[model samples]
Target: MKDFFVSLLFFGLTGYFIYLIVQNMPQLFTETTTIKQYGLLVYRLIMVFVLFNLGIVSSKNYKRSKPA
Candidate 1:
């Protein structure tokens, strides 16, 4: 019961964060110059990679702490 609510909150926040990122994605790609556009592209890619790894790590830790 408690665990169910906690997982629900975690997933809800993750979904909201993804929504915000998708909402701002166009602006991230809309730089005036080509170089700036590529820079933003690389920045976005790195951010995605970092976020993905962080999610994996956190989920692994959560599972470890869960009761068998």
Candidate 2:
């Protein structure tokens, strides 16, 4: 149960970090409006895919604790 919760916390943080990165992208890099929009779209898609992989890893790692 503890391990499961810890993984859930990390998953949430990963998503929030992705959001923060996308929102502050304009300050990080300067580009034309059209290019910037396309770049963000690509970045979001990639990050979402990465999140899916994290889910897979978390699922594989979770083990039910046996009673003492």
**What lDDT does candidate 2 reach at residue 1?**
60
Clashes of each: 0, 0
* Residues 1-68 of candidate 1: C-alpha lDDT, one tens digit per residue: 44445555555565665666677677664544477666765665566666555655666666777889
- Steric clash count of candidate 2: 0
What local distance difference test score does each model get? 0.61, 0.67
Using all chains and alpha carbons, the TM-scores for the candidates as numbered come to: 0.54, 0.50
After aligning candidate 1 to the native by TM-score, how far in Å is the CA of 6 from where it should be?
10
Per-residue CA lDDT of model 2 for 1-68, tens digit only, reads 66576668667866875786778677654554577666876777677777757765765567535344
What local lDDT score does residue 25 receive in model 2, on the 0 to 100 scale? 71
Candidate 1 stretches with Cα past 4 Å from truth are 1-33
